[model samples]
Target: MKKLTTGLASASLAALALGAITPGVAAASPAPSPSPTADAGRSAGPAAPIVSRIEKHGADRIALLGVAPWAEQVRMQFDGGGSVEPVTDGRYTFLIDKTHLGKTATLTSFAGGIEGESIDVALTLDEDAAPGIIPVMPRVLGVSKDSQGVFVIEGTVTYDPLQFDQLEVTASTGGMPIRSVPDVNGTFTLTIPAEFAGRQIGVQAHLGNKSSAVDTIDLLETRPNTASDTHPLAILSPWAGAELAEPAVTFSGVAIPNSQIVVTNDAETDQRFATLCETNVLANGKWTCDSPRLPDGEYSATVTEKPTWSSVTEQTEGSSFSIVHGDWKPAAPALPHLSSITDSGDHLIVRVVIPGASRASLEVGEHRDEQQGINGRFSFWVEKSLAGQTATVAGLVDQSVGKALDIPLTPIADTITPAPLTAPVIHHVADEGGHVYLEGTTGYAPFEFFTPGVIAKKDGKLIGSTELTYNGAFILRLDEEYVGDEIELFSTRNLELSTATELVVAETEKNSAPETFPLEVTSPADGATVPATSPTFTGEGIPGAKVRVEDTTAADKAPVLVCGADVLADGTWSCEAEKPLAHGEHTTTVTEAPFWVSAGTPTTTRGFTIGDADSDDEAPIVVTTPADGSTFLAGSDVTFTGTATPGADIALHLGYGLAPVIGTADAEGDWSVSRWLGNAPYTATVIQSKNGKQLSGAHTGPTITPAS
Candidate 1:
């Protein structure tokens, strides 16, 4: 009987163990049995005091707390949206959206277990003086290909519900701007217009009068593949509209299990003959196949699922694909050499000598066009705006780079409208037999002057005369044998009599060549500061002679050729640097090497500096609006606010490869930036800049967690 009693007690204790406390929650003590007098009224029980509390979190968020048992079936109604959940510690937590400050909130608790009265609580939210909406700028994450053949732009918008009514994203492809509204998450994904293909596009986000910085992307050189809706098998790798970096690529997709998968570029032909990959589908219905190294071209693939047992054969339509050699390296070739540069008053004439080139083109400032040349020789006419600028001439054969040349322009006088000449002057005179070849300068502009005439006489007696072209150039044939006398050459333009230029022939030497001088720089006056990266380097050199320019700034550094050129017939040469030079002092040496033997070295040392036009290099200061380390919903928007130097611009970079959003600070140095991030642990950074230069370091904010 004693053992039976003990067994009964053991079983009773086992039954009591079922009411144990849950993890992370405090165990509640059982209420003592009511006294006999207190339970006198059998149908009635004493009332328990209502327990409730309220906590303010931020300008827009509030927390409501209460006892767990009583909080069950409790409802709190306020503004915007709110949620309630029970915590393990016998407490109920309610996240209330306090959109209207100073407004009363009602919390009603239902009767507990049908024995208690329903309780109602009222409370007013604390007043907030801060501005309702932050002025943070919007930003873009980046650009990518959507399922469609077009591009999709993604970004975020952080704004105040009380201030702005809407946020819009816009895209421009040289036509009417396309606009879109961000979803509830403050994130937007917009599809570009079909007409945007082969065009440079610009995207931006707008909120009323405020606009985000324009983000530009180039799609002019690429062709994205559009997916076919009929294909049952979806190609996973080398996704449609994907720009690949390699030619040899692998394709992956999903199809029916145990069925044969055949990938081919040709839809009309049997895939088995020109199959890129042919294999039995895996148990999981996934398959992957690699193709041979493909040349840079467009490709398509289709799959055929062969039947087994009672299964029927199925074939998928062709899918779009392309092979672009974005990383292909080409063989290096010799560069085209600049031969000469001449200043022709209003325009600069540059000549280049390219070798082994079948075609060539000249690029002068914003103008680029193909030009014809005989024997690899090309000449380009540069406008006045190109003064002190670099001109490039590219030689091509089979659409491949054969050679390239760069020349500089430095005119002696300002660009002026040609004025009629007061008089024509005779300059060069050469006598062959009784004929005299002459070249001269004229004040008359092109296409304005008539043909010129020249008369020759010895001792005031008419000997011979000839008429010449209107270009102020002539050759007088004096057939008379007026030996041992001073012969005068008189030039007349349109019957306007001009003074005679005397020419005496005394013992003319046969087979005599004109003298030539070495290379020398004349314009830009030595030690003058020029405001250009490719400043024109001008000087005198032997006519039609080649010269090489080498920058010898530092002895320890290797010599860099800034430019190369040929001397013009007028003994002047100009060449622009092949590339811009860095800031600091530079000493360039120009050497004349017409025949690559016994060349002349006449070097010039000049000091110049290049300044950045965009930035001041000052670091910007950034602050997070929600004060970092905050938590939010998975698709909720997160706003960040910070301070920087007044008039500085701020940008917020969200994690997960998203494009950055940009905002400008007001005069008070206050700024706010916002973005809706994905559900994950994210640490963001704020960048500040004045103009285009960075003013501050990457001011990073605390990490934030977004829950589902």
Candidate 2:
């Protein structure tokens, strides 16, 4: 599959308020301290209501934008019986049935009643008189060095994806554009020749009429130790040029089974090329590392081992292979952003937006037809003689493959019956006492009734299955001994079945839970406002239990499964989001999965706002215990204290924009922060804000000289 992993950063916005002012520093105003309020720890209040909208994209799908910071506690039901699924970044999408063209969707807030905030939104849409094109662009995530010292590029193509069917990666050094590698799901990975290393390369995607903005990445220089002579490692199977059908395969060979092996792409130039695989060699002297999901491409896998008997590492020549999926590698875009398939009895209807394709075909089993692509849209129907057949829509711009959709067909009894083909939404899965309980909502469609089911499996063996109620709500309880098993929640629409969502019942027999399930967040101080987008989340949980930190800001908010570390023996854990959260009040919840303990785990929640979007005019006051111009040794803990608006976040910046320490003020409007200092002449200041606005002036902090 094509791997579009590239990304681009937006320019930063300027802050408004100045906290404390100090002489001899330019623009040295810091933010004031933060204070907790009555609404502290609350996820949603009357401050902001959820936003909802319904609009048609191209001609096939409807874009449902109901995601808001306040959407987590909201329950939704549509007037026409159609269902929606949450996508990335708090957004959702659903197929637009012609029967439900003029329908409405109602959202009722406070579904969880956790914050007592109530509101409602009714979204209605009319057929578009003037359809607009949805823009798509390619993003280059990064470039890595492979075992053979080549660079591999990865990134994604995003947007409603009206067009841009071709992908290319070229270096500033100028060579023919590397065009069209096999891609899957809009992401592509290409191996760069060794000569392109250490140069700035422009990665772009192309459509018949337009191209995406060029994303650039500087390839790292190749290291001299490309081949290590001392390491003992060899790939045992799948020799060079071997062909594999699966996206992922296991690479095993002889090595110090108990030692560490770094396996990587032989010619990719990214830091991740060298992946450490720890091992237990089988009795036959085979060690293994499962390769990551790879797109269609030629790749060489290399392995290096650190033997237990020697400190020196041994490297072996890599094994090369090819992964071939389908024949068509079209530069045409995938179906527009919200393309979908509907099962209609003996036939399945497919609709998608494929820009610039004059000819398109809907292929199901042995049936194929020349379909038209109009206004970046393609809609057609194919005979569904066999249920569960894979549906493919191949669109061609000038007879070349440009866009394609591979949708799975669900079985339906007849055209008159409606089915909830959308997948069920899993709400929560936890261990209550010694039983595992799974709860969620089933798929729904107008005039269609859904029967949800829960399936339990271990090691690919079906352990159990049960049907659920007609209310679209399901509760499945399992024995505690099945803690490590995998559970799937599914719903059946008409004769068509929705895709299942799998959740693992964590194994926690060794690291027993504490009596009260200790999980508490220390930073952002429960409703404290800070300027940073990705603030650090620090807390304590059961020492051995796996803690899942979820951005519970909205019901549609996809949880961040593992943002940080495993719980330390001391029970403390710290993690931060790889990307920044939305710029508003966000509710974050930490829950311990069913690990070591048999009892249900209590969840801990906190709320905080990301400030610094809008500027505040008020100046803040910052006061540190150590007076300005004082001297101290390196590695000494220093305490910084200040005052600000009762709830403003105080950011203590040492030097200029370096070593920032944040603290929230107490009810008394006083705040204290502490951190260790390395050897340097430190000038202190603070930046204060709430909801991205400065609440006070920047406060100038004391300066201390750190002695070596």
CA lDDT, every model vs. true structure = 0.45, 0.46
Q: What local lDDT does model 2 show for residue 395?
A: 53
- Name the TM-score of candidate 2: 0.26
List TM-scores for all candidates, in order. 0.22, 0.26
Q: Please report how far candidate 1 places residue 666 from its true position, in Å.
A: 2.6
Best by TM-score: 2
User: Which regions in candidate 1 have their CA more than 4 angstroms from the true location?
Assistant: 1-275, 280-292, 295-619, 628-635, 677-681, 704-708
**Alpha-carbon RMSD, candidate 1:** 39.1
Off by over 4 Å in 2: 1-517, 525-536, 541-548, 552-576, 583-586, 591-603, 607-617, 633-637, 646-671, 675-685, 689-705
